[model samples]
Target: YEPSEDALQVEVDTKTIPHTEFLTYVFTDLSSTGATVALDWAKKQIPFKIEFDVSAIVLADIRQKLQGEAGFQRQNWEQAATFAMNNGGDLQEALGWINNAIEGQFFSSKTFNNMAVKAQILQKLGQKDKVLAMVPEMAGMANTNEMNNLGYMLVNMGENDLALKYFKINAKNNPANANVFDSLGEAYKIMGDRKNAIKNLKKSLSLNPPAGVKANSERLLAELGVVI
Candidate 1:
């Protein structure tokens, strides 16, 4: 069944809660296990607290499986994908599972983040034209995170012009997000626009990027002789 936007929102929110507590509640309050139980809880609860809890559970489960042994992780991911797809999980969930399977070396906190990033890089190396053709159609209809993902994809594909367009859109839409500025800088840098690159990179630094991103930006600045 195609879940409504509201239902999808409910799923996203529930997938954001702390995994342990969310799982405890699922086992205790819901008297069940697995994605079905979590999904059922999502369907039954009001769209407020319950949704948040379910989102947490889902995220936690994904993280756990990602961190496990590689073979086990792949198996679990396939199982999760199959379960989610068969049981009315949305396209986002299915795609997320597939991504998880692709991002190797066991799961870890950064698996999905790294996968998204790496995919963006690969698209740059081999799929620039295709990515440029697809991103605009995906922009508004896709979730914000996924849209940001598309932005990364565009950047990696060396479609800096197109990537900047999406980054600017995301930055305007989410002014508080520092990563948008960082991504914008990368796009500009690729375009050989050092001035704007430095400016946006500074903005990204000001926002206190995640450690990995901060280091990367610093390295890039150093390479450019920007002396940040």
Candidate 2:
């Protein structure tokens, strides 16, 4: 079966499957790729062939199954958390599994997704305070673009104050990066703080941001009626 749109394909020998076993093995193996992908494939392609319950394949259980897998444990945990969050599974359980993933030795590679998923879970669980408390940790784990995107997400969620907190942490952690300040300036703009907005926009421009950031900063300044 070819999962993706590309030409790569996977051949499975169905002869080994007993009638009762059916597609359970295939479902479980596909889950190793991700529960969401497995569920999507099952729902769309093989509706009745798979008989497993979604809730039974818990994030906690998947976390346990992924233990001591050599180098891929962190990635597996991250995928588990993502699946739980996306598939209407338990949010609190997903939070724990994702925290485990983040604390794993190979976390840096999965940092962005881990933090993003955790923040989303926290928000969904009405633990917005925890999201704020995660600013420092997020700054450490997530890259500049990831943090910036999270901050903008908060802004879109109308949590301008929380967005400010995230942007501030990003700016502190990435002092030389222009996008951080640009995002900070944008957050301030959304919060109706013209002084700080203009301040950070100027800072972003002074640091020689990329063309997109430069144009955005210039446009914001112009809208604020400030001559650059």
Best of the candidates, TM-score: 2
Put down candidate 2 lDDT per residue, 134-162, tens digits, no spaces.
76666666677887887886786677887
TM-score of 1: 0.43
| Tens digit of per-residue lDDT, candidate 1, span 41-93 | 32242222332345457655755765665436455665565555444455465
Cα-lDDT of candidate 2? 0.74
Q: After superposition, how far is residue 138 of candidate 1 from its true place, in Å?
A: 1.2
Candidate 2: Cα lDDT at 94: 81
Worst 10 residues of 2 by lDDT: 36-45
- Model 1, runs deviating above 4 Å: 1-133
The prediction achieving the highest lDDT against the true structure is: 2
> Global lDDT of each model?
0.60, 0.74
Cα RMSDs, all models: 18.9, 12.1
